[model samples]
Target: MATNRSEKTVSVLKIAAFAALTPMLLAGCTSIKDRRGYVMDQALTTAITPGLDNRQSVEGTLGQPSFASQFGDPVYYYVSSTTEQRVFGQPEIEGHEVLKVAFDAAGNVSSVTTAGMDDVRDINPDGDKTPTLGRDRGFLEDLFGNIGAVGAGGMGGGVGGGTNGS
Candidate 1:
């Protein structure tokens, strides 16, 4: 009788522990969603009309842009991205958008264009070293190569051109 009761109690405790931990286990598997940059609003974006809407009006409609072109024709870029990340994984871009509002010399909106995920490009860098047009140097060469070159041309040996005595 004592054995039967202890076994039943142990089984009930096991079931209760599993029930409490089940939700947490499932929650850990869910991907975390994150939104970055300017949040897009359909109505506000639609309100912007080229030629009619100027910089001020567009700013009032869509608020400030994510960035603006510094050179060439003036353009305002409203960029947004939605990413999902697992518990210990890098965030993957699920959605991306870039709204480009170009302006003429008059500062009025000349053209409005929206680019979606199709314009998104994935760039994988080549290892840790940056590729350059120079020669490939080894660890020893990099350390000792500069030894003879620095003071050879009377370049960096002295701090100033003046004599040591004032």
Candidate 2:
């Protein structure tokens, strides 16, 4: 009887210990993310050759680019990234790529370039002031600019702007 009771207590302790640790183990598990643009297949991307693949062919093969340049040269960008976010923490970038395809003025494929995250650059604006051509107004000018612009509401001919037919 003593041996049986000891074994039962040990089993109960083991179960309780597992139950207490189960949540902690699950909490350590993290979520992976395939974000932004779709993942580019190596073979498919390699098949795209500049000067040979035009807009139509490129679209037909690799699909539309993640973004297109708004300025000159008409460049298309294929951006892809994989991120991992931990519990209650900002996501960390695991992989990133920027594929640029330039189109000639004639609308043909001009060149293809591939760059990693190291190529990214942050732009810093030149000055604190935005530089406007208009004249600057003082605080008093702004505060009193609209003074006397409006008259007393009682001077209006119609009280409610409604006319009753006689």
Candidate 3:
């Protein structure tokens, strides 16, 4: 009767709803691939010559570097990375490259070195606090620790120290 047709309609609607949502649910589990930093061009990078290429020509060849050395010899670092990330997950480096171009005192390229993921190192710090020679202190100790230290160190002419205020 009419009840049997209504039940069939409800079942079909349920299937249609699931079909519409199946792709969306799968999309959440899919990984997102991203490329960050400098895009490497093999031809242009290889064209850079140590003795021939200077800062200006190098910049023209490879564009601006990711960073440069602040001290010591002038070195330009071109860094690139490809990472994959899932929903609510940290991005993992799938590929990484670092090109180091060193310049001599004359600002001409001295050396060109390339590093891959094999050179990448994960540095896990030892907890949040930096290890120090001093003893560990609590919250209240830190807040009030300097209370007596300021005047305790031979601060002359205090209440009980210098000739009792003669």
Candidate 1 residues 1-166, lDDT tens each? 9999999999999999999999999999999999999999988888899889999999988989999999998999999999999989999999999999999999999999999999877888778867688899889998888876766756756656657653
Tens-digit lDDT track for model 2 on 82-132?
Answer: 788877788888778988889998778888888887876767888786766
Measured against the true structure, the TM-scores of the candidates, in listed sequence, are: 0.79, 0.66, 0.77
**After TM-score superposition, what is the CA distance of residue 42 in candidate 3 from its true location, in Å?**
1.9
How far residue 85's Cα lies from its native spot in candidate 2, in Å, is 0.7
Number of the top-ranking candidate, with TM-score as the measure: 1
Candidate 3 accuracy as lDDT = 0.93
- The clash count of every prediction, one per candidate, is 0, 0, 0
Q: Tens digits of per-residue lDDT for model 3 on 33-128? A: 999999999998999999999999999989999999999999999999999999999999999999999999999999999999999899987787
Candidate 2 achieves a global lDDT of 0.83
For lDDT, the strongest prediction is: 3
Cα lDDT computed for each candidate against the true fold: 0.92, 0.83, 0.93
Query: Which portions of model 2 show Cα errors greater than 4 Å?
Result: 2-7, 10-27, 122-166
